[model samples]
Target: MKARVTVMLKNGVLDPQGEAVRHALGALGFDGVEGVRQGKVIELDLVQGTSQATVKEMCDKLLANAVIESYTIEMA
Candidate 1:
């Protein structure tokens, strides 16, 4: 099985890195860029029977920070 996790800041959270990217884009003449948000993707290879519940537990415990971030999981 394969699992993918996307981790990102919550809507109201601040993103300094994203802001930096937006600013740089504007400086480079990309004025149409208004907002930017950054996130990370994690890919995992699991055993055949690994369950979504177990993967979710991984996210809850370490992959994401519940206070400031959220995550989505997909399995294949």
Candidate 2:
């Protein structure tokens, strides 16, 4: 099985890197770009029958920083 994890900043969080990207894009004439919030997508290969609870544990333990970010895991 494979688990895909997406980690992102929560709403109302400040993202200076994202702001930089947005500003650069606008300078490049990509004016339609409004906002950009940087995030990460991670894929993990796991043994079959890996539980959602276990995945969440992994996120809590290592994959995500709960103080600044949130994560969602999808299994395939």
Candidate 3:
């Protein structure tokens, strides 16, 4: 089984890295972008029976910071 986790800053959190990227894009001539939010993707390869709930536990315990970030899990 494969599990993919996406971690992103919650709304109202400051995202300096994302802001930097947005500014860089405009400086590079790619205008019209008003905002940018940065996030991470983590792919895990597990045993055949690994469940989504198990993955969510991993996210809750280690992969994401519950105070400032949120995560979503996809299984395949």
Candidate closest to the true structure, highest TM-score: 3
22, model 3: CA deviation in Å? 0.2
lDDT string, candidate 2, 2-36, tens digits:
99999999889999989999999999999899799
lDDT of 3 by residue, 1-76 (tens): 8999999999999999999999999999998999999999999999999889999999999999999999999998
TM-score of each: 0.94, 0.94, 0.97
Q: Return the top candidate by lDDT.
A: 3
Which pairs clash in model 2? none
As for candidate 1, its clashing pairs are none
Scored by Cα lDDT, where does model 1 land? 0.95
The local lDDT score (0 to 100) that residue 3 gets in candidate 1 is: 99
Candidate 3 ranges with C-alpha deviation above 4 Å: none
Q: List, residue by residue over 1-76, the lDDT tens digit for candidate 1.
A: 8999999999989999999999999999998998999999999999999999999999999899999999999898
Order of the predicted models by TM-score, top scorer first? 3, 1, 2
Give RMSD to native, each candidate: 0.8, 0.8, 0.5
